[model samples]
Each structure stands twice: as C-alpha cells, then as structure tokens.
Target: MSTPVVLIHGMWCTGGDWKRVRDLLEPRGYRCHAPTLPAHEPTADQPLRVGDRSLREYRDFLEQYIREQDFRTPPILVGHSMGALLAQQLAARIPVFAAVLLTPAAPWGINAAGLANLAPFARVLGRWGFWNRPYKFSREAAAAYVYNGLSPERQKACYERMVHESGRVAYEIGLWWADWGKTTSVDADAVRCPVYVVSCGADRLTPAFAVRRVAGLYPQATHRHYPDRGHWVIDDEETEEMIHGICGWLRPLEQRAARGQQAPR
Candidate 1:
C-alpha cells in the first residue's frame, strides 16, 4: 500500500478545493483523502452549523477520520489556511510522517493575519457575532485581500466555490488570546515529523512575515516563499513548479522509508 496523504483545505472551501493537488498525488504511488469540514460541504448532508464549531472541533474531525482509517503508516498531512492550523494540531497529537502547510493561519505568535486584521478590508468577517455565526467573505472582500492577484474572471469562478465557515472557529483563530480553550496553540515540540511550509508574499490574509515565524518555530523546517504568488497557491496556472517541488521533496523520504522496510505509506 502506498502512503496516505490527507489534503486539508482552508476556509470557505470544501475538500474539493484540493482537486489540483489530489490529481497530482494519486498517480504517484500515494492515496489521497480530502475530508470536507462539518456543514461546509458544497451540498451539506447535515444541518448547517459551521458557525457553531470551534477550532478544537475542526481538528477533532480530522483526527477522528484518521483514526477510523487506521493507515498502515502515519499519513502525510497537507493543509492550507485554517486547515493548516488543523494539520499542525494533528501532528502535535498524532504520529504524522510529514506535513506541508500552505499559508497556514496564525496560531498564537502571529496576530497580524487574524480575522480582526481583516476588519478594515472585510468588515463582515470581523463583525459582531463573527465567532458565533456562519460567515463567508464576500467576493468584493476577496478581491481586496486573498484573491487580489487573480484576474476578474478567474476571481469570480473561485468565489463561486466558496462556502460559509464556522464563526466559532474564526474566533479561535483571530481572538486566540482571549480564548480560554487554548484552541489555536500548536505544541511545536510534540510535532515529531518533517515540516514544509509555504508563504506567498502577495498574501494578505496570512502575512508572509508571520508565516516565516511559523517556519522558525520548527527545529528545521523547509519553507518556500513565493513573492509572485498570492494566497491561492493552487491557481489554475503557474502551479506546476510548486507541485513538482513538493513531489520531489517527498520522493526521497518515501524511498528511504521503503528501503528500511518502514513502508511510510
């Protein structure tokens, strides 16, 4: 059996958002699992309560799924934005082979990327009850922030796939300082696995500077900063290079594990 790869997506998107990455991984001796957040599905089967979920709850969902699968080896955890934070938490708690965090949302040390910072650019996301109601940033807001680099047509298309995110989860991320739950704090010391982090210079939602701090937290992390790219790293174009990079990084590790009879899949 090949190593499993869990593809975790950011806010306002479902597992389908990882399509570009998944398509590339499956053909390369890897099995991909992309689980949609609760009530964040394109066509949600359950009642919509996304706004009611906390950061811990989101991480728990990913953890539960992993435990149920009971993979032969610790799966590679790949995540973006909010999903990135979840991946970090999972690695801290479980036995993960590796993690690829793409513009991961801030946990504790970084406050610049919080939802509070988006208040001026996107008021709705930071409005009252943001931590207690379902919310999805408007396309206008996206154009001003996360979706800035894309053309108008492309931006529109990406916006269409957007969905409501958990307000409580937002609270845990942005207002983590006030949270007694300690939801967004990642135990860096507990993450005993290889870590790869990406930060886009053009990204405003998760500032590259703060993301750099994320890489620094790890003992020796692999981080690539793309000055030209925006938060949408897996855009329809100019993505093959990064994807190839990720593939190349994992190949040697997988080969070594296989050679040692560890399988790593």
Candidate 2:
C-alpha cells in the first residue's frame, strides 16, 4: 500500500501550483492530493472574508480534510510557505507518515528579521485595512522576491499565474502573531514523524538562515540546502531535481513500512 501524499501550496498560490510535483509523484505510486486552501481558490464566484481568518482556521480546515479521508495508513504531508506552517501544525495534531517543508515560513518564536526581505510589502503592511483586503504582487516585484533564480522568461511566465494572498495570514506570519495558546507553534517534542526541510538560498521572502533555524528545531529532521535555488524551487529550473530528492527520501521510509517496521513517531 502506497502512502498518501498531500501537497499544500503557499500564500498567493493555489493547488494548481503543485501540478509539476504531483505529476511526477503520482506516476511513482504515490497517491498525490493538492487541495486548495479555503478562501484561496483563484476563481471563486464570491469574495472571502480572509481578513478574519487566522492560522488556526487554516489548520482546522486541513485537519478536517484529512480526517474525512481516513486513509489506511498515515498520509505524508508536504507543504510550501504558509502551507508549510500548516503542515507542521497538522503533523503535531495527527499521526503522519512524514512531512516535507520547502522554504517554509518561520513558526512562532522564530525571528525573521531583515528589512530587505520585507521591503517589497512596505506599502501595504502599514495600512489599517490591509488585512481586510486582498494583496497581489506586481510582476517585477514577484520576480525579485520569488523567482530570483529563474531566467527572465521563466519569471514572467510564473508571474502570470500568481494570485492574491490573504493579508491577515501574511501579517500573522510576518509578526509571529499566530501563537494562540501555542496552537501555531511547531512542537518538536510532539512531532515524532520524520521531517524533511529543504531551504533555498535565494528565497528572499523566507531566507535560508531563517529556514535553517526552523530545521534546527526538529532534532530528527533531515535538512537539505540549495544555495542557488530560489523560493519557488518546485517551479524553477531545478524542479525535477527537487522532486527526485523528495522521492529519494521517501523511498527508504516506504520500504521500512513495507517491511512491517514501525515508523518513528
């Protein structure tokens, strides 16, 4: 029996963003699922009050989705950016086969300082109603912040597919305000499953140093560093290589399970 894999996308993106990785994983016997987060569907008929939504709400939504599925074996959770934060929270709440985080945002207590990293959003972050409104990045800004490792042509193509992200969520991540009774904190002691963290050196939004700090929290985690890759590693030129790396990591875990070995919690 193959382990179920759920791919969670970051802010300003939808489940479709995981298409490239899903396409590769599915053919290799992994049951891949990339569900869009609530209020994040790009073509929704009505506007969502995402400003009122919190990190707990997003975590709850994912928990419910996985519970409803009731898989035979614990599913592997893979997430990027904000989704990665949710994945970590979910792993602590439920039993999972494993978890993979790509350029994930720093969790509660992790300091992500540096003016240059947040300079692009300076204009909107100060607005009183910022959380109540949708936020989208211009092509040029997106290219610099997210696709710095890609060529000009590829950056433009990726920019075309970008969507608006929830300002409230962004604010929470930026200020580390998601710590509601430790709900948003990644409790390393509680997360017994294997964790794989892949950090991109060129990720301005969530820089390598911050991500490395996150990986350090999980003593049992396997950390991979890509000094030249950008934040959007899953969609960049090294997409295939990243996919292969994930597959390589999962192969041994799957084999252990197949041999009736208990996965360390």
Index of the highest-TM-score prediction:
2
Q: Can you write out model 2's per-residue Cα lDDT over 1-265, one digit (the tens) per residue?
A: 6669989888777889898898888888999888888877766532354545667788898999999889999999999988888999899889899999999988888887687688878876878877666777778889889878889998888787777777777677776654455545777778888999999877898888999998998887999999988888778788888889888988988888889997654
Tens digit per residue, CA lDDT, model 1, 1-265: 8889999888888889888888777888789999997788776632266778777777888999999999999899999988898999999999998999998887775665545346633555547766778777777887667677889998998898888877777777776777887889999998878888999887878888889888888875889899977888866465667878988988888888878844232
- Provide the lowest-lDDT 10-residue window in model 2: 44-53
TM-score of each: 0.91, 0.93
lDDT (CA) per prediction: 0.81, 0.83
Which parts of model 1 are misplaced by more than 4 Å? 44-48, 114-117, 120-122, 261-265
Query: Cα miss at 11, model 1 (Å)?
Result: 0.7
